[model samples]
Target: MSTQSQPSQSVLTEEESWELLAGQKIGRLATSVAGEPEIFPVSFEVSGERIFLRTKPGTKLAEVTISPRVAFEADEIGDDAAWSVVVKGRAQVLEREEDLAEARGTGLVSYLEDGKTVWIRITPSDVSGRRLVPGDQR
Candidate 1:
């Protein structure tokens, strides 16, 4: 038996990336604090060209306030293959009433009892994705 070194991966278009984001609910948020990097599982909603998430006042919120730049990623795994999408953008804390109202209309529900109602919007500058396939597919 022989083993292949590289598996096949298909690059997803921008539209496809956005579509995947809209369809997926759970994603990982990449942020940094005091030079250390961290990734947290987040529930997000896609609205137009921005991604919105609700988080309480905590480290994740504080880190983004100082850095602003962040990355959000979501993926799907199958028995034989997997797909991943990433959105690189800046995080902004929404405080205006209008902004909060608009985000509330998106049907965002928080599973935490800590009242994670602070809205954070990530404006994507780059959206990309890839779908991996088994070596046999190549």
Candidate 2:
């Protein structure tokens, strides 16, 4: 007879979640406009407890302005393991000069060719993550 352990899932700590989030440059931003939900792929940077991303005048910006509450998610998957992080909080456009300067200092560049001139900051009220380790199936 042989004994085997099944795959397991674990909840990540807040620090672990932040570490994972900081390592990834791409994430999905979920926003709602009059109860209509939309998600957008964005390139972002983590600074302290805040997340920053650049965007142009578009639906994403418009939605954020309309509904400041949003959600951001990032994840990594591999053959052996996978992890995901979710951040729920309020987002705002960087309007103050000091804030704009700080955001510019993050060196965050948009994947788009041009027009990503607006900086939005996400201040997370809740952050959570999960990690999954796969077991042998064969």
Candidate 3:
């Protein structure tokens, strides 16, 4: 008889989660409006512990303003393993000159050609991540 090890899933530490987040340039922003949920794909930058992204005046911006609480997710997949990180926090629009200037320092640009004039910052209250290794299943 032969014995084989199974695949495993594990929760990532906060530091590991942040590291994964910092490495990714794109994430999904989750927001709720009028008891409904919406997700927007955004190009983002991670500085320290916060996430920043640029947006135009539209659904994403409007929904975030209407409900400041939001969740952001980023993930990566490899041939042998996969991981995902979720950040839950409040989203704030940067209106102050200093904040706008700091956000600009991040050099975050929109993937779309549309003008993205607004800067939004997400300050996370909870950040968690999970990693799955497929072992031989790969």
Q: List, residue by residue over 1-138, the lDDT tens digit for candidate 1.
A: 565556789999999888888888889999987789999888888998789999988889998899999999999988798989999999999999999987888787654547897899999989999999877632
The root-mean-square deviation over C-alpha atoms between each candidate and the true structure, in angstroms, is: 2.4, 1.6, 1.7
Q: For candidate 2, write residues 48-74 as lDDT tens digits.
A: 879999999989999999999999999
Q: Cα miss at 81, model 3 (Å)?
A: 1.2
lDDT of each: 0.88, 0.94, 0.93
Residue lDDT tens for model 3, 58-88: 9999999999999999999998899999999
- What order do candidates take by lDDT, descending? 2, 3, 1
Q: Can you tell me which runs of candidate 3 are displaced by over 4 Å?
A: 1-4
Candidate 1 colliding pairs:
none
What TM-score, computed on C-alpha atoms, does each candidate reach?
Answer: 0.89, 0.94, 0.93
Model 2 alpha-carbon miss at residue 71, Å: 0.1
